[model samples]
Target: MSADFAGETARLYARFRRDLPSDQAAELAAQLGLTADDLLLDLGCGTGQLTAPLLPHCAGAVAVDPEPGMLTGLRDRGLPGVVAVLGADTDLPQLGRVLPPLGALVVGNALHWTDEASALAAGAALLRPGGGLAVVTQGPPLWLGGAPWQQAVRAVLEQFLGPVTATCGSDAAALADRVGLLEAQGLTVRVSSWRADHPVDAAWVLGHLGSALPGDALTSGGLRQALEDELDRQTGPLVEQVLTTAVVARRT
Candidate 1:
């Protein structure tokens, strides 16, 4: 992991709590075919965004992250069937020892941050025979139930992130390879993708980008003003985004 990632993540989590939707969790849980007897280990589980939705599908959850603040938020949610653990991706052996053999292991957008090979190796160890590993990445700017806003957000994000067409980790494919690793351990691997029409308000967009914006250079109001101006220039009055993804290998 990069030296700055942890600090950046803490700030991002504070912002994400407001902007990110829980619906993606439901989608992921469904895709993995989560069952009542399943024990899921959530990799890079941030503030229980994915953890909360998995509660209904699984008997229990092990939410892991290096950030204490993120775990605190998950705790604050008062979610049932959740056990939040603080650790890094390489700490999987310790995690495995803490939680029993898991039926499924999952990571949301943060899968990009971990060492893919190590993660795959660790996940293979954690899941029992025929267990599954779901590595998912979300991308493209879109608005909830608003086409115009979606266009606006896309334009703004492209400009902000600098010509990024999609959001996928450099190691996304390797992370998915965990399915093959599990297969070697006796599990069937299923790789797939899904789309969702996610919704969000202007405040949602602003909060999502808040922490990443350089506060020393621009005040909160200033950043908001800039974003509003950009949105106006890109798409005026109502926008909706098409939420797309590459979900690789949900081991069955």
Candidate 2:
């Protein structure tokens, strides 16, 4: 857990990050054969983005994240049947001692942060027989390689952050690696996608970047104004089609 997603940064993340789709949750529930007795374990929950929507589909949810600040305010967000825990992928075995039998285990946009193979193995151990495991990629950031408007955003970001690429283990090669891991455990891999479109303005870009960069000088030292100036000139549809990919499989 980095300070980038802690304290004030966590608040920005909670406010700016989009909620995970209910349709996707439903899909996982069906694939996992979720019953009223099964609980969903949401690793890297990050303010319950996956947990809240998933809770209704399962008996209850165990939302875990390593960042303590990131775990704050999840309970007050009108979520019932949600238990937030400050833990990480590496702690799954110990965490499992206190958790119920899981019908599904979801790692949403957080696989790149740890030893992915180990995390996947630990997650598998916690599942009940015939349960499902899903790894979701939250897609690239808004300023990731794209149209000219985004190129301009990228340029400004590069000036401050020094050569950034949106490689978050969502690419084809990373997916293949994940699929192989699941197959090693005798779980057949199935990949699915859910998409949400976000139109970027200066404010939206600022919030999104702020969430990721928090406390960085990128939004300071006059770079914020420069980014705004650069964006003001680019004219085209700047909608970011966030294609959320789910690499899923069931225990066979």
Q: Candidate 1 on 65-175: residue-level lDDT in tens?
A: 887867876787788878888887899988788677887787766765778667767876887655667765544323222365555655555454445343345234543
lDDT for model 2: 0.81
TM-score of 2: 0.93
Error of 2 at 74 (Å): 2.0
Q: Candidate 2, after superposition: displacement of residue 230 in Å?
A: 2.0
Name the candidate that leads on TM-score: 2
Q: Quick one: best lDDT, which candidate?
A: 2
User: Model 2, 1-252: lDDT tens per residue?
Assistant: 133578777887787777787887787677667777788999988887778777777888888998888788576586878888888998899988987668999988888887999999999888888888999887766677466787788898788777778577778899999999988878878988877777767787777777777476655688788888887887776777788888988887
